[model samples]
Target: MTITINRLLLRADTADGPYGTDIVFEKGLFILRVENTHGKSTCINSIAYALGMEMALGQVTSKPPFPPSLLKNIQNENGTEIPVISSYVMLEVSNDRGQTCTLKREILGADAESIITVYESDIESISNNGRNLFIHLEGDTSRELGFYYWLAEFISWDLPLVPNNSGRESPLYPVLLFPLFFVEQKKGWSSIQATTPFHLQIIQARKRAFEFLMDMDINETVNSKAKNKKLIDDVQEKWKQIYTQLESVAIRLDGKAQGVKDAPAATFDPFKLDILIEHQGNWQSLTSALIGLRADLTQHVKASQPQVAEQKNESLLSKIRELNNIVLQEDSKYEFLLNEISFVKNQITATEVRIENLVDDKRKYEDLKKVKSFSILDDLPVLNNECPTCGREYSDHNVEIECSDDLMTLEESLEFIKSQITTFKSVLNSYKMQLDIKKIELSKLEKQIDKHGADISRLKTELYSERNVLDEESLREKIRLENQITEYEKGLVAVGDFRSTFDILHNQYKHLISLRRNFPEHGFSQKDINKLDGLKTKVVKYLSEFGFSSFDPQLLEISQDTYLPTREGFDLGFDTSASDGIRIIWSYLISLFSLREIFKTNHPGILIFDEPRQQEANKFSFTGLLKGASDAAKSGQIIFATSEEEDVLKGALEGFKYTLHSYSPSEGKILRKLNKGA
Candidate 1:
């Protein structure tokens, strides 16, 4: 990507006459040489103003950066000040692909500083064709009708989105990138990338700008990591929500999820976790309990009607005997189930104790590993299996015990303990399931025995009573049981549906973990590393040429973490003198500007400096800077404004090929009244 300024036209339509200046830039090096206070800085500022980028020079506001000559009043040839009625600045720029566009902005009208007029053609044809775009407004950096968006497209730059202070994303505004190549006179020389607008709330604004300029892939890498992390968090949150819902429903059904985790894990298996309910001091699986309730409801519905005709005493006695026999059989089954449930519960308790012991042992070995890592107590007798005083094999002093060579190392022991814990947990779950089944069977048998006893009582009552009537109590009991069964069935279905989604959530969790693992370890690709290395090399070379003296130029390095120049892992600004700091800034900015020659960069191939020589840099250093700029200009353009004397400046130029636009003392000023055609 390349952006080159072809011309800057500043026009002021005043009450007396037109007062402005027009300056055209060539392909290579262009120097604006003039006396002090001759509008050199004004010309430089006009370029930014016309491009709708004055915010780079300072804070963003409605006030323009131009002098009063174009804003309030202007002086005529007779040295008389004239009031200015209106003014505007225009700049024509072209890209590497030879596409040109002229930008115009008014300074003193209704559509003042916030509006920009873009002509698809060069400055000469701007009057014939133009389209109005807006700036300094919301969405100006991204909207199609915004000037920055249009400018970015024209420059062939696909701006990347950077994170802002609000924890959201915003485009890397063009103003941020301009400071890298266009340095104003006042604050641009204060530090490296000094003109960057931090108030935009862009996090690490300088580093992000550097990455975009170098075309690094770190942004995509970071975005991918953030995206996957958000996905994982979402999956976990949803899993927790589903678990909470399942728990609520389970509680409503007089049951709870057993051995189930609230958080989703790749190792989670829904089938292994049991849902159990407790009734009459016995625990049973929810499914089994529902089945028993449904059976009871069926039996109640079958027995809801009363007999219409009287039965013989012999028939009643026969029915009562049959119910008594069923009661006896069910009571025997209930006792057997009770014994089985008791044994299983004991086993479950023992397995749980074993698992806890194994877990504690694992934790101890892990702590030992940490101690060994720190080299503390590394040669302890117990840790090395030797006696402390004699350096002999240690013994536990157990007479009947025999020592073996198959003992495990600390790491191996930790692994063994982990496996033991896992095995015991599985055993505990199995025992609990067995206990649940036996208790459920016991509950069912007890229900059967009670039902048979009730039947026998009812038969005896009928045999003694004379009057026959509808059993309204039996009907009400049947209806109540049926409604309970319906509710239990609905809860069972809901829990079942929840369990089904576990597989999907677990799969999503695993996929997100895989994506996280696949991201680059350092968040930078090989290409990004190569570009950074190249930049470091150029920066050191430029520093040497510019006579950097505060430290050894060879000690300078571009930091990968902050993307700033450093000295032996420390910041260069700490020990650098004022002049050396200026030199460092020049080297850093020039190296970035020149990178387009070697790599595919977003550098616009144009560099503008209000004053390249600052901080009272020596003549040789200034000359070296000029030469460096000249060499860089071979492929692009370098425009700088200077106030050096003619002879000294001429000496500095030496053999360089450059365009000299000079305003001598006799010329008085850069902006003057235009000649009349008549």
Candidate 2:
């Protein structure tokens, strides 16, 4: 759409110039080039106010051109201020078929005291050469499309992106993806495109841009979306995998949180996945440790039979085995101590296989960007591979840890188990060695005592024969030797160190059980211990696809068909690598994304932006941004405003299409198209 403004004219009752411009357009791209400090932003914003009630650009832009009962508040910035705003804007919307529509309006000044709500004259429209009429005012009315409704007619917008809504409105949302088309010095013009989720918003915006192209179904353009169809499908497939994984994760994860028995009524309900997922998140570590413990105990039972010590208490072993089964319960609380030697081992090969799959699935998510381009991607980046909130790098080949809760490594579990198993093996092996030595020592000791006792008996008999009488002294000495031999034999009856060895392992078994039960919130009940792997996959899938810190955690509160923002706030959704230079990016993105969406359905006759430079705003690279915005304006009509023309304005909109219009408060002139080489 080639839209133009030729020496825009605005008429003041007295000597002031006309408050409007003459705009024209043809085809889809702009024919005008905006120069630096070009006052282009103002023209854009005035155009926005001209078309809609809401602020399309920055603060002050939302205020009506005139204030209600203007005398009460009367000073500009020196603490005193008079409230004023344009009552209406006149526009001549023309189609290639030579169809033209004009709109003029009269507006009431806003309540000067009120900040909670304020609006200029709402839209008033005169269609197909009709007379000027009030759209929202009392009594004196004209049905020829109220200005506000007319604005809406040009752009049908959905708020908070009603996901459950029907038709094209479902896919619309705010975005800021202004592309740069510069006059390249060498190698022609090189386009360094953005690959981020922000593009999602752009698709929504371009959808609106397509509306003005010619009265055709813009959804047809989406068929081209099929060209990137494989990519989007892959994204969806990946998203589906992500979705399935998240759901499974919700199930497999430790159920620390309970499901809602009753939901409260509100315009919006937050998503409940986080609560369930959080519950699952809390139990992950316990799940892994239990698995290791189960493994170790099974090996113990299979490798050895109960010694005589255990045979005396078969019931004790039986009780221990019962505890082991608790770990198998769907909701059984796993707790401390000796699992039974009698219990048979169940293969949890699933956990291992799951872990491998998680590793693989996660790896695929990382490498997703490498597989394809957004063949139909028409706008700026939205979902950035890197976090726009935090400056973090994400490669196509590595899983983003911050995005998903269920995704985790065995780092903690492995570290813990390694220490435990090492000590267990050491103690078990040491006892085995000691027990063997003790058995041999007992044997040697017994034999020596037996031979010594016999020697003592012979000495006594030989001495008695020589003496030929009682021989009490010899008998006493022989008795002493015999007693000493008996004591030596008693000393060598085995130390029983094997029992001590078993006791140590028994404690480890008990400790592991205790850990799982005591930390129920973080502990997986026996039922969930086996579901850890499944839980990880699901959490990773969703988080990687859409979860975000700025994710408006309130997005989780969605319910029914409506939404009431859980918490109210504004943001300029820019990516991490964008630097401090891009803080303004989020607000711009949101405004643009929303603006674009509004443009699509209602298909507004014009677009607008107001004084957009923010405090702490770095102006570098902004010229190209404006240039792109202006080029985008060509599809319809665009206007923007700025208080200052710092160099950033020059950089942001370099080499783009736009009719340069200026607002001169000193000259009392506005909407004047700046003619170059004048």
Identify the candidate with maximal TM-score.
1
Total backbone collisions, model 1: 1
Model 1, span 192-283: residue lDDT tens: 88888887888788888888888899978866776687688788999899888877776555566765688876587777655676644566
The superposed Cα distance between candidate 1 and the true structure at residue 250, in angstroms, equals 4.0
Each prediction's total of clashing residue pairs, residues at least 3 apart in sequence or on different chains, is 1, 97
Quote each prediction's TM-score: 0.72, 0.29
At residue 443, candidate 1 shows an lDDT of 55
What lDDT score goes with residue 15 in model 2?
18
Instruction: Evaluate all candidate structures by whole-model CA lDDT and list the values in order.
Output: 0.82, 0.33
Q: How much does each candidate deviate from the true structure in C-alpha RMSD?
A: 9.2, 26.2
lDDT of 2 by residue, 63-108 (tens): 4433222212322223333333432334444443343444333333
